[model samples]
Target: MQETPLCLRVGHFLPYSMSDLNTTDFTNPSTFILVGIPGLEAAHIWISIPFCAMYVIAVLGNFSILFIVRREPSLHGPMFYFLCMLAVTDLVMSTTTIPKMLSIFWFNSREISFSACLTQMYFIHCFSTMESGILVAMAFDRYVAICNPRRHSTILTNSVVAKIGLAVVLRSGILALPYPFLTRRWPYCRTNIIPHFCCGHIAVVKLACADIRINSYYGQFDLFSVIGMDVFFIAMSYTQILRAIFCLPTKDARLKTFGTCISHVCTILVLYIPELFFSLMYRFGHNVPLHFLVLIPSVFHPVPPVLHPIIYGVRTKQIRGRLLQLFTHKEI
Candidate 1:
């Protein structure tokens, strides 16, 4: 027989067994589990039930808010415009991941195809950025309303609000585009198991065959940039709001300004603080606790959207009144 080249022999090299051929030699697949809840599958059944319930509430609440904003003449202002955008964002955000989560939980099919996983991850990032953008826009609206009430009518007019809404979607879309593209570029050399209920940044990145240094850099930069920018803008807005409130000649103005922003403050803290902790934990404390995996991202995912309408509805009299009136009225 003709002498075979060393490269050809090396290429055909088999390491002792058929199991080696079947198994992914690059990395271990069994270590990462796809359990959404720890301890008990029974408990997970219960937890997923509530999680699905929360998604329903999120959908209904956000739809109600959207309907109220669109139908009401008096609510055709910047505040309600931002509110409508938020409602849409929340609806999309919940819908993006909840269906997959519920499907997996009920049917026990945790196998997400490459395309499906990437698509889910894309929307998760998209709406998340949109929500952040909406919040920032809301803060600016508040700042204008309190800091310069005279110009609120002129500055935050319908056209202005529409422009801002467009900008929000555009910016978010641009920022989140890199995630899916970059994610798809890297080949997966091992198991495609994704922890948690959805395709998240961390869960997807862990499977990359190539060096993910750029992914990590982008992740850090994007997280801090988005979060930091939001905090900075919100703080500046609130400072102006507080200044306007404190310097006010009337108690009603001060109280109204303070009260209006109270809802926003609550929403911001609830959404961001957990995210900050989780970002830090994921960046540095990834090795510490398994519970942190469930704890960190879960707080930001379904909870923020579910809680947004509730907090604003309970805290803001106008929004609450409109929402109540919409449901209480029967068909004549």
Candidate 2:
């Protein structure tokens, strides 16, 4: 008998046959396979346990912040409003990737449609940009409350806060608009395997067979323009805040004023430190192991969401008091 064709023999074992792999539609693949983390497939189950716990904490903590902020009148201030925005951004950011990521890890369901992959990529970047903008707003709130206390309320009026929130949303949406379009325009003739839990813009773009100079350049430009500008503004705001804090005559007064900013500083550090590391690793750490490269984004994305509410809840007096009251009331 004649030997069976390789495509026919393997057709039952794979989604695509050997022949189909060679003839896959370059410009429009039906689906892309996410390999989670390369070289760590055997440990996906173990890896997912902490991730799942973090996701649960992130969801509950952010929701609790939102609910407490909404219900408690004492927490109604410009800073708290900004905190609400931050909570919502964190919730959406984590939600956008974690569920699908869990599905991949638990069920080995890694195939994501091209359009769906692009949508995930867009939401991840958009919310990340929004989170950075929200942090800047929080820093500005702290600066005004400290350095310009006389006009803090007037400067960050309800109307002004609403306008700032609108601006952040519009800026993030517009800046992130180009990412999906840029990635889509390229023809992806290479293998459809993306070695990540979610569709990262650079990860997806690298799979394209065409030259991706524009994609790479735009990614750099977008990262620097948004994150760089936000960081600069936050630093300037804090510098002014510190100067104002030191001008207070009493040591206790200076400490009291500075205490107000500790939470914001902590929040900024948690967000930017990991983000900077992830960006640098991707751009320059060519010698870094593939698993490390994949794990960084996985850790950074959900970690801030899990930590932000805890930081705010514990550090902000009104939030902490209200939380204690809430739990105590439950006990009674």
Candidate 3:
């Protein structure tokens, strides 16, 4: 028999060949492949059409809110200031993920470098946390306005709103700072195929061969500490607002008082309900269909951004009037 080559002899003792070891770096992958949806890959183009439309609508609606709020002097109250912040948050959140998703759908350009993936992951989670904090702030605004009308202006002054906005930013940034770092430390000996459009925290972390209990436990801690506390505060605020509404002397008064809260309530529901569903599906839906797993997050990301500005524009009298003036070129 011919003498075996040294490389072949070595390969017989090793799990991988010399060529394989030279070509593939298991500890640090150069790039990751992102899939739109595992089972529905055939319909990516069709799915992208509606997603593109929603992105357009979301961009236009949020820009309109910012423009109208800034231009109109009548809307310069604490409430409208908070509205502007919310619009900004929605704009960033949607812009962070949707364009890349559309690119994936349209061009099959799914390879993202490891660093770029971490950057995307950071923005997605940071903005999500920020949005939750802003909603809590909005709830507090309503609570003060309804429950303690006398001190509303004094309590939520310009300075206070600015401070609250800063706090939201800081909290979100700090909470999301660890995600990229935590993910980066892991050795990606496993495949670098992420089954979701965006680089979600859990999805990316799952690809690591290292033990991920720290990641999992910290993720749960972050989620509950931010979202859970926010939900509790929002609930308390609304409870007080409801009691105040019931105590109003006349039916007209009650209707009018609750009317101011309708838009906020709708916004809160739109933001939180889908988010909660997605969270539950991730944690407890081991037997859930793969398509549903993909679909929930795909919908959850874009739907709230599309609905938030529309809800406010339709529900707020000032915004609606300004929109009418904008389109009609005449005073409403």
Instruction: Return whichever of 1 and 2 wins on lDDT.
Output: 2
Candidate 2: tens digits of C-alpha lDDT, residues 1-332: 11122113223434333454534557978888777866677788998999999999999999989999999887788999999999999999999999998998899898899999999999988999999999999989998998889999889999999999999999999988999999888877656777678999877887787787887898899888888999999999989998998899999999988998888899999999888879878866756766688887787778899999999999988888878878788531
Candidate 3 residues lying further than 4 Å off, grouped into runs, are 1-25
Cα lDDT tens digits for candidate 3, 153-264: 8999999999999999999999999999999998876466676788988878877777877888888898888889999999999999999999999999999999999999
lDDT of 1 at 234: 86
Residues 1-332 of candidate 1 have per-residue lDDT tens digits of: 11122112222222233243322543323232244533234555565777888999999888878887788788888888888888888888888887776776687655666667777778887787788888999999999988888999999877888898999899888888888788877765544444466777666776666677777788788888988988899888888888878998899877876988888888888778877787777666644554456544664568888898899889877778887777787431
235 in model 2: Cα distance from truth in Å? 1.1
Query: Which is superior by TM-score, 1 or 3?
Result: 3
The alpha-carbon lDDT assigned to residue 32 of candidate 2 equals 83
TM-score of each: 0.86, 0.92, 0.92
Give each model's clash number. Answer: 0, 0, 0
Best-to-worst TM-score order: 2, 3, 1
